[model samples]
Target: MSEAVDWGLALATGVRTASSGPEMSMTEAAAEVAALREAAAAVVEPVAGITALSAPEAPPAVVVDRAEWIRSNAGALRTVLTPLTDGERQVGGFAQPVSSRLAGLQLGLALGWLSGKVLGQYEALPAESDGPQRLLLVAPNIVQAATVMGVDEHDFRLWVCMHEETHRVQFGAHPWLSEYFAGEVAALVRGLDVGPAELAARLASGIRNADSGGVAGWLQSPQMRSRMSGLMALMSLLEGHADWVMDQSEEVVPSAARLRVAFEQRRRGGGLFDAVLRRLLGLDAKLAQYREGAAFTRAVIDQVGLSGFNKVWSGPATLPLAGEINDSTAWVARVRSM
Candidate 1:
């Protein structure tokens, strides 16, 4: 069978289309990189203290341009889809180069567009087998976003670091998390091997449910419903937890309140075309995760205190269910029983 995706083509296409925001001289870029690295380092202790979770010291954060961010994500996508391309559950058809190329192009377009918007990401997948996990900070995007939001660059950078650092701490603190996440992704990919008829039906169902689930709802297939729900819940928890931690560290970021207000406004900003694109990309759903997840975290903490809330980090079973995210009382009751 042909490769499921022409990763090289995808990388090239993405790099070509990705926006290079706020051109900077080599000196400016270097200085921004240095500042971001410092911010990432500074957040470690505060994040650990606030969350009561310790992340093992890892390598320094990698600061990349928009094109480089696309490249890194392309590589990670390849790693994730390997099972579908090369393992026992290989997706049928697409043996022709044209088919693979088309898939690559579609993926490339999405990644290229997204490269400009993301501020930072915690890459749990190593570049090479046995390589250390990395925290990637997109310097150009960060600089551009801060300018657009009219916030202090230093404070905004630190604020973004706090959120991304929480992700690093999450995976590092729980060794099983990365593997579990990967496994769920692999399972979902494997489930995509259905025939055209079933695939269409699933897509139709997803569209119908889009009002409720966003893009993620449209992407879900019946076979993968349970797995997708669990994965979504996990993502909601991670994003929400990170946001909560970032807000709690206002002492460190004196402009935290101002930044949050601007950031929320920014998340809600953008014209009609942008709004449609965000929904298509599941970004709207992602924004909901932050809101819903943070609310759940706040409720849980209020009800049980921080230590009791910490029970979530124990394992997969301890995490909230999709329904429970909105109803934290149910989550608290269930976990207490556990």
Candidate 2:
């Protein structure tokens, strides 16, 4: 897998003029990463309770510190999950490595972070790029991955490498992937024009009593319901496929299921104080929908089988709209007929 590669020194640099537009500058990416690191540290350091985790074989103090820093942030890390969202903010677990046993417990989160970051970055790729657009930010925990996954650092690195490389491969193979996803997201954002009465009413009601987490919450208005539906539909397919790819490989990794279940529980459990969602995205749109999306994808896989499920990803036009997920049998037949 170590083919021709760039150390990514210039990779994180600001987005120069690409076909899409000006990409985020490296400086901006760094600042963003720094801010997230601080956020991750803030969450983890407090959890440490002043006593460092006493491992039989801890690395040097600095390595441990870096590892702990990433771990602490693992539970609360947040930023763009997908390129569809601006800044593509998502939590940091995908970039950080935890113990392999712990890896399963956190799979949902890692997938959430990974799926969003990887796919979001893919979607954010500017028009006509030669390869995977440079990552504005990458979160990698050299020490954590080794300890958590019971794998060599290089192997763990390969895991992340695969995630990033998949973005490149998917986009390269199907150039329209990013555009289709981003367009749906932009549509949702555009649909989110709060009405004067609703905005005024929301203001009058005071922020504390807001339907902040509901579908009609601050970030997700009724108007944007269609956008939410469409975005979820798209996300379900993308993430479903990514998770399947990661889970299906028997040769490379054997414990993906354990990791996935653990991760799903964490995702379902919601954040401590439920602050992780609000602090990161200015919304809690993901907390509820992720499980639903997972189920939807699993249902598709079960009903259609891998080949049929994989076939769904052949093109953007074939993808199900928000309406099709609830009634997938109809679409399954439609897919089969076509």
Candidate 3:
């Protein structure tokens, strides 16, 4: 595996980066898992009203701590990124022996800290599953968010589930989405022509000059952004759709606004260290996905209504182009012309 396997070190260090936090008792974790499952059931019909997709498979909800959450996801990340890593390995010597070790440390620390921010994830592994996919909820993070927001624990937990279950339905109903997303990811990784050392040095340079240029300055070059655009658009659509569905779930939580406020606040106030990690790790892009995507979704739904909006799910081709995400009218107009 060597230093070429930066993700391996990333897992080790990433978990370290995020606070594992105080462990929840087994009983507490189990109870939260059950509550999340219940929330999924309650939300299905209402969420269906928002989108054409349905939760056909009643996947089990998993409640895990920060360490376990990272552990479980690491295997999947490895599977997806291994090809790219191997490709980088071919361009050897450009990366120093210490470079891989340092990258590993950085990755691990980043993940460890990120554990607190992640509320839930839909881990897709159709090859391993005979029944249905798994919905992972980081128990500690959920607890932390609830406490931080001063909201009802159950209400907050359910709110998190709505977003995840919507994710499950989107991927589950549209198997093509899984393949398309993976293909995009693989293409990006395979296209990389540098080793960890060179990449890190560039990233360090990017960070230094990034302040003047802002996110555009150091985060991505023109080619990188073009390559990432389609993936970004897809992510925006999925996340924004989930956010829209969660909001449409008016009956699920009475104080949705406060819940939103709490999460928004949670993303901020990370201190200088946290800010650097977020930029280095590309988390800023992730946070922006929620805002941009939700806005696109809202604009489309307002213009087309739920039934009309279903056209997006009709096929991969119907999905919005990268530029359309920022301009809702363009997406709506494009869909209409089709």
Best by TM-score: 1
Q: Give each model's whole-structure lDDT.
A: 0.74, 0.37, 0.65
Writing each residue's lDDT as its tens digit, candidate 1 over 1-338 gives: 56757778778887888876897899998999999999999998999999999878888888888888777777776665565555543445643476667667766766676778778888766545466677889899899999998999999989999998999999999998888877776676566554322222232233223343333443457757777677767777888898899899888899998998999987631211122223433444436866888999999999999999989988889988879999999999999997
lDDT of 3 by residue, 1-338 (tens): 45444666767776666665646687976776677667757766666666767656665676767887667655554554456456446465533556666765554554565567677777653323243457777777777778867888877877888888788889878888777776765665555555544454434333333232223333345675565666667777887788887787658777777787777776531212223323443544336766888888888888988777778887777898888888988988888888
Cα deviation at 144, candidate 2, in Å, is: 3.7
Residue by residue across 1-338, what tens digits does model 2's lDDT show? Answer: 11011112111111111112124476854554454334332322221221111112211111112222223223221211122122222222222223222322332233223322211122232322333233221333323333444554333333333333333444444556666755554454344443222222222222222234332353556556656655666654444444444444333434545555544443322211122222222333344444444466667778976566656657865787767766667668878887
Model 1 scores worst on lDDT over the 10 consecutive residues at 269-278
Candidate 3: residue 97 lDDT (0-100): 54
Measured with C-alpha atoms, the lDDT of residue 50 in candidate 3 is: 61
Report residue 214 deviation for candidate 1 (angstroms). 7.7
What's the candidate order when arranged by decreasing TM-score? 1, 3, 2
Candidate 1: where are CA atoms >4 Å away?
A: 86-92, 127-129, 193-223, 268-286
Q: How much is the lDDT of residue 145 in candidate 3?
A: 73
- Candidate 2: global Cα-lDDT? 0.37
What's the CA RMSD for each of the models? 4.8, 17.5, 4.8
